[model samples]
Target: MAEQVTLYTNPMSRGRIVRWMLEEIGQPYKTEWLAYGPQMKSADFTAINPLGKVPAIRHGATVVTETPAILAYLADAFPQAGLAPAPADRGNYYRWLFFTSGPVESAVISQACGFTVPDDRRPMVGFVDMQRMMDIIASAITANPYVAGDAFSAADIYIASHLSFSTRVGSVGSRPVFADYIARMTDRDAFRRASAIDDEARAAQASKG
Candidate 1:
């Protein structure tokens, strides 16, 4: 049976990541593209995700929000996708997952929005600084073909999304390491199919106005 998954997302948002996950899932799914401002903040949408964020998915009765959570859920929910590493290799699997999802995300978004802590209070920031955090990510990917040692996992999806966005926003340098890793990840057939759909959707939405 086809999976009954409803993806509620904004065409131009992090929803692309969930779309990629859906493509990787290789199951029939529906998408309810949402508009920003009032539409996203509407009561119905808020009931799905209190924060009114895109990339939220409704799988059966389970609703998952946040990019990392959604991706991880899909990986587990669709074991045939081969999105998770073996049990033994999961040590680094989860380590980088939380790291990229938490501190690294804060660092990148905060810097992009001009939100920063003072020098004295910088220590309170888990990532400390964007450059340092990115350097850590770069070194890790440079050493391994994938984030969690050898296997390709949902962890790669989260980290790769961050790296791609970080480069666009100038949060991280466009070093060869970052570019090479992204190239490797994005080249996957699943990613290509998902991104093509998102790109078309975004273009169509833009042309409407």
Candidate 2:
């Protein structure tokens, strides 16, 4: 028997990404919905994630946090799902995965929050040039159907999710390549199931207010 997996998440957070990955892995996992603020900061929750963040997962005795880390962990835990490239072929997989978690995430959040990096300090920031960053992403997505390479992998999930959110929030300028990539990556059964579950949860949460 497989070890039980539990997802601690809020419907509206990046937990949705983990939801999608879980669906793709076809694993039976339990979802514990947490409201922001009090519920998330509660001691019980903090014991699982010291940062009081949603989107942490418990698989048997292991605890995994951080969106990208969770995705990578699930892919490795369920290799039959083929969400990760073979170990020797993970150069681009690890590259784009951490790239999205680092530079892409940093740039989008900073831009959306109206924070600007000083021109002199551009070198210090990983995603200093917005245009250049988007161009690089576009090149990668357009170069192949997937981010890592010819095969769809966990990297695609993180990349597509980030681009979808960034474009929707106006943090990143809309581009045909981005839209195309998101559409292709999300037009899967797993993605649809995950989105529907989250949408329903989101509606239910809103109705409670």
TM-score of 2: 0.97
Error of 2 at 34 (Å): 0.2
- Write down the lDDT of every candidate, Cα atoms only: 0.85, 0.92
> Model 1 over residues 69-123: C-alpha lDDT tens digits?
8888888888888888876768887888889889888887787789969999877
> Taking the tens digit of each residue's C-alpha lDDT, what string does model 2 give over 100-191?
89998888788778898988898888885788889988898888768888899999999999999989988899999899999999999999
Task: Identify the candidate with maximal TM-score.
Answer: 2
Best-fitting candidate, measured by lDDT? 2
TM-score of every candidate relative to the true structure: 0.94, 0.97
Off by over 4 Å in 2: none
